[model samples]
Target: MTSLDDLPLRDDLRGLTPYGAPQAPLPVALNVNENTHPVPDDVAAQILDDVAAALREVNRYPDREFTRLREGFAAYLGHGLRPEQIWAGNGSNEVLQHVLQAFAGPGRTAFGFAPTYSMYPLLSQGTGARWIAGTRDDDFRITAEDAAAQVAVADPDVVFLCAPNNPTGTPLGLDVIEAVYEVARGVVIVDEAYQEFAPKAAPSALTLLEGRPRLAVSRTMSKAFAFAGARVGYLAADPVFIDALRLVRLPYHLSALTQAAATAALRNSATMLRMVDEIVVQRDRITAGLAELGYLPHESWSNFVLFGGVDDPRATWQALYDRGVLIRDVGIPGHLRVSAGTEAETTAFLDAMASVGSAA
Candidate 1:
């Protein structure tokens, strides 16, 4: 049996742990922030048909450009985006990895507000770039002034901004994004993986893409589209910025089946996103439910809630687990996060929380 110590691993990765959430077969699984709803049957049928059709040419390499999928993404995103401005990969993680590989590696640095997405630092280190963690406002929010000051100081080659941040579910204002872009001389990425679940009237970072060649807004199908298993993520940026990713991507990185499935999902974007409205309702319900239980539920624009005031997050997490309901202990000393699931699943989680008593 060989251990990691016996292998010639990169010095930077020697003591680093891989990123992942605990996976269990618990009955009411709400960890990992996945869309807990199933894909609509009609959409699933269409995707299956598209995948089957693609199988006919499986012997050949997939469309190297994934042209139709890019067009589909442009259409879905619709800030007058064109296909040339779109790029995608296995998941948003890969999409961000491409950005780091193209802009930040060995000797260069990547920066993000601390307690943002866990993957930002991981992706930076994996690309051989140094990770610089900056501070956020008191309640996990980012202010324009603070953001500008931090970026000006770090002057990193890459910056990641998680809109409606994970772990704490705090929303990011466009002012802060514009502020960071104005100060940072490097590529600035706005990860909007949970954007579809945000308030409908909120403007996306895509709205700021024009003329800001260094800014990129990335999105994922894993949340609102119920396509997590399909693993499709994409971003909108200047055509030239999209071009830079081409230098680092592996040939035929996306398979024909994946391209087909994601395109089909995009074509039925309306139906695929119907689940978001219901998920929002559940997210609010969880917030209200937590408040009634004497916990501090943060304001969330995404399909999950991160609450504080837990005396022991691990104990509450385990108690919920024992009752067959699972949530995330996102490493915030007094906080835990849980995804908004189907109505019944949400009820189960709340009921389990009530039984655990108030840890506030």
Candidate 2:
């Protein structure tokens, strides 16, 4: 067999590991920050019908523009967005790739604060863009002034702001976004995959999109809509920005089935969102439970919680896994992340943590 070392590969990817979270089977799995709740029955049935209809037409190519899907997404967003301002791909990762391909490539650079979505750097690397890991405060918060300073220093071609950021679950304030935007010389991408799980008052960068052609806010149906299997993710941006993504996306990138399923899910957006409150409740429960167990839980506006104070994060993760519960270590030193699941699942996770003894 030819060893990988014997084959010619891109120099940048010769020794790189793929981006993925552990997918170990466990009785209570809270890793990956997936929406634990399955799609509701009624919505599932509707999606089934839509997808079946789409399958019949699979002999032909899917709508290249995904016009109806874009319209559905715009309607679901309801911020007076037009379909022309929307762009989507198989997932938010692909959507981000489109943006990076369009704006940050070759000699350009992409900058983001550390402890953010792990994929940002990887996406930049794939595009041959220099990835700059900027700094965040000790509490994982990025203040407006600090953000502005970093942007000024990096002067990157693309800036990524992960609101309700992964690993840390810290939501960025509008001030921080505005400050970064003011100093950024090129595109600013805001990843809002978990925005629906945030508090109602949490500011969306979409509100900041009126005149900022440089701004793009990406959203996903995977989290709050419980449609991860559909692989639908989108962004709201200026039409000019959206147009640039068209140049990078593959032809018929989204299959007919995917567009149909995601469109149906968006049409039933109200039903999909009904689960947010319950997930938020479970998230708070996990936070409080971790704190009571002597762990330091970070404030989270997303559907997951990141807590620290573990003497050995890997050991704690293993201990919980031993008891049939699974959560993410997130490579954050002493911290780990656990997504909010059903109430019963949350209880199981908490019980498992208690059995393992916290902060040890």
Candidate 3:
């Protein structure tokens, strides 16, 4: 077996670990912020039929442009978007990488607020762009002033804003997003992977796309659409920006099966997404349960909750795991994050937490 050290590898990636959370396959799995609900039977049936149809054309290459998928995505977004203004990839990570490859390179830089999505910096570094980890306030919130100030100081070639951020599960204000765009000399990517789970009144940066050519808002079907296994993530941006991504993405990047499944899922969007409100209900239940257990839960607009005040987060995590409940120890001191699972799974997690006595 050739060891990694024996093989020729990029010097920058020599000692870096790959990105992933633990997948222990416990009874109550709530670690990765996945939609716990299975694809509803009706939607699953449609997806199977669509995929079977595509299988008949497996010998042919997928639509190089994924034309119908783009059209379906545009209709789903419904903010006057056109197919030309939409782009997609296997996942949002790939979409972000495409954006970075087109805009940021060896001499350029990308900046993101710390404790946001862990993958932002990794993606930037992979593109050979300098990565700047900016700071947020004590509550893990970024204000418009702080964002603009950071952009003005760093002068980065790209900025990433993870709305309803992961690990912390806090939503960024539209003001902060627009403020960063005003000051950023390069592209601004707003990641809205969990937007569907956010409160009904929460504003999306999608509304700010009118005159901002540098702005891009990315979304995923993994969470709300219950299509994580389908690997379809997309972005809505100016036609110019979308065209630039075409230059960097691989030819026929999305597979025919993926395109068929994702398109079918979007066609039945209402049926596939019916669990969103229920998930939100479970998220609130988890938040309230955490508070009752004497933990300080962050205000979350996403499906997961990040809470603090654990004497030993690792030990508490282990305790929960011992009871067959697997949550995420996101490396935040005294903090842990758990995704909203099905009602039974949620109850199991809460029971495990109660058993562990995770009070401050």
Candidate 3 structure lDDT: 0.92
Give candidate 2 regions above 4 Å deviation.
none
The worst-scoring run of ten residues by lDDT in candidate 1 lies at 134-143
Candidate maximizing lDDT:
1
Model 2: weakest 10-residue lDDT segment is 9-18
Look at candidate 3 and give me any clashing residue pairs.
none
In the range 113-137, model 2's lDDT, one tens digit per residue, is 9989999999999989989999989
TM-score of each: 0.99, 0.98, 0.98
Model 1: per-residue Cα lDDT over 18-92, one tens digit each: 997899999999998999899999999999999999999999999989999999999999989999999999999
List where candidate 3 sits over 4 angstroms from the true fold: none
Error of 1 at 146 (Å): 0.6
* Model 2: pairs clashing at backbone N, Cα or C within 3 Å: none
